[model samples]
Target: MSESAQAADPVAYIQHHLTNWSTSQPKSIADFNVLHLDVIIFSALLGGLLIFIAKKIGENLSLDNPSKLQSVAEMVVEFVNDQIKNVFPHPDKLIGPLALTVFVWVLAMNAMDLLPVDLLPSLWTGILGLFGADPSHVYLKVVPTTNLDTTLGLALCVFVLILAYNFKSKGPMGYLKMFLFHPFGKFFIPVNIVMTTIEELAKPLSLGLRLFGNLFAGELVFLLIALLTLGAGFSFGLFIWFPMQVLLDLAWLLFHLLVITLQAFIFMVLTIVYLGMADATADDH
Candidate 1:
């Protein structure tokens, strides 16, 4: 943590921060990704917290002058409800709640960026080391959106929901019939199948990659700011260094909160929209 200590092991320190706490190495080069334990635990915990808040909001509904919590809840609920109404018709039964929960949970997960970048991961690694593992080998990335595993896991969840809606809205035969017949007609079943497969693959891949790309960029920016702060006085002749670092970090942190919320909202809404498309009775025919 000291300047000399950091200088002595620059690459090692940076590499340690970059590594993930994973179960094991994946099978191949294509499967090289390992899980980030911090992302998984915190994201799930935030999701549960979101659900708890939603439940509490439902319990303490007041029709008069809305309290601060109620107002916030109303705004989010109304936003999701409006989107559901506009995009997915007859969606009162399920899409409303689904959209609401997805938005809240995704936002909560993204909000993990509000924590100082290395704090959680450092603490986590230390705790893991106490159980006899090597501290250097204990790697964890706290930013869920920065990790492909985190985004892909969420995208996979959306995939499952889309599949469920497909089956629910249309029987197995109806669902198959859409790809097998509707789009390109009977003569081009092969082509239609390929197109459909691409469409399906694109959903999760795009969804995950979109979130991953944005968050990863934001994280890189933060890291760059950190490096600047570290190299400030030594490189820049000890000029109003700490204050400048604080200001820069503050500005970026403020901007990143907006980025985090927007990215989460977009991911959730896109997820709902995609699933709604699958539930489209018109599209199936």
Candidate 2:
């Protein structure tokens, strides 16, 4: 009935956190649509944090010895800027901020996984229930990348950037010419168009899947570790289970930290690469 009651049942605690705030019925295996509010809220908050951090950087910048914060910010800025500079070639006044945002925002969002997974969700859910809403519907997965909706939304944003840069760097005719003639003869225009379309479609798919799959699996592994403390102890014996469960959770979490960083980097780098591709010139080919 209450959290104290739920605390008496480990199975229910983890199960409640894992449950989705979905509208669909579980008719089959495919009936899963994890209504992940944590991902959305975390992403937006991180995005806002990125902008604020950027503003602070801009306000406090100096040529003398930099503060630790400024140095860290500069390192991230330069890293993203170097990647964009290498790929895009055009020194646009606008693209720099967007690219920097991608790098920082994603890094922040991915960093959420470093928090004790259930702590924030448990806190927020309790807070929500105080407002008279159903706490179950406040479903949260702290790692935004764990949700298909968030990752796909991010990938789609990158896709839109590609389109924007395509239009900005290449006129309508140039963009069309890219689809019609880049890889082969003009006679193969139709096939080329279809191939190019598929390639474009694959960008978001790859981006989304790469991030989503990694984080989702990582989350599941943690859930599995949580399960380890369950029936194994009650059915077998506590002596045989608790030690292995602690070791396994620690090891899995340590490994997942690397994975979360790698996935975030991969996603950001892909975004920059796609943006760079959009800004490519006909002469380069």
Candidate 3:
């Protein structure tokens, strides 16, 4: 859109930015009517990028005069291994790599927020227009972590690992005993069942919602900051908003760098903790 068009109705522009590139319109809150193409595309691209970088670093490793990329890669691997050893006492062969993947993938996804909000969308819209699609309808959201489905999907994958470890460490009967007897003993088996169910369910719910809520709020704030720069038309007074906008934008962006990294670390740490908890045998439970 032209500057005049955007300035004419900033609300519409904000709404357009918020919209997703989906397969179709959703009919209801529970409907799975449309797939978020933007999220899928960005996520796949990031995942592929991670794989490519890892492969390149692995193939180029040198003990003598290591490259910066190799050094960073080793550092990341060592950090994740230490974290896993600390939390997951009997760390499985898969745990270190899984934790590393979660940390890097999430950090990459969250890093998308650092890009100018309108950059990808405007570029995508222009490309779509050239292909005979309506530029106005080419909504694109580059941040996959900000999408609930993506976050929840990650949580669910962790949940499955929790279940697997639970079974592996405890066996079926012991697992049943975990839910049937516990904090209240055999007399309170009914309460034990209900409480245990809720506790288990809360893990994934909290995991997904925490990441989604934070990123979604950050994305909205960026949009609002962007909106502050707009006006119906040019005026001498408009210059006054620019400095405030610049200061706020820089401050928030700096703070958000910590937020993105912290969130990714938190998610990785919690996944290790949850899996460790699941690894508890009947005796420990």
Q: Best TM-score goes to which candidate?
A: 3
Q: Write the number of the candidate with greater TM-score, choosing between 2 and 3.
A: 3
Ranking by TM-score: 3, 1, 2
* Candidate 3, superposed: residue stretches over 4 Å from native: 1-6, 281-285
lDDT by residue (tens digit), candidate 1, 20-52: 666775575347465556667878777788778
Candidate number with greatest lDDT = 3
Give the Cα lDDT of each candidate.
0.75, 0.74, 0.88
Count of clashing residue pairs in every prediction: 0, 0, 0
Worst 10 residues of 3 by lDDT: 276-285
Q: Sorted by lDDT, highest first, which candidate order results?
A: 3, 1, 2
Superposition error at 177 for model 2 (Å)? 2.4
lDDT of 1 at 78: 89
The digit string of per-residue lDDT tens for model 2 on 118-225 reads 677778788888998676456666767766777788899889878988988897898999899967769999999999999999999999988878877777777666
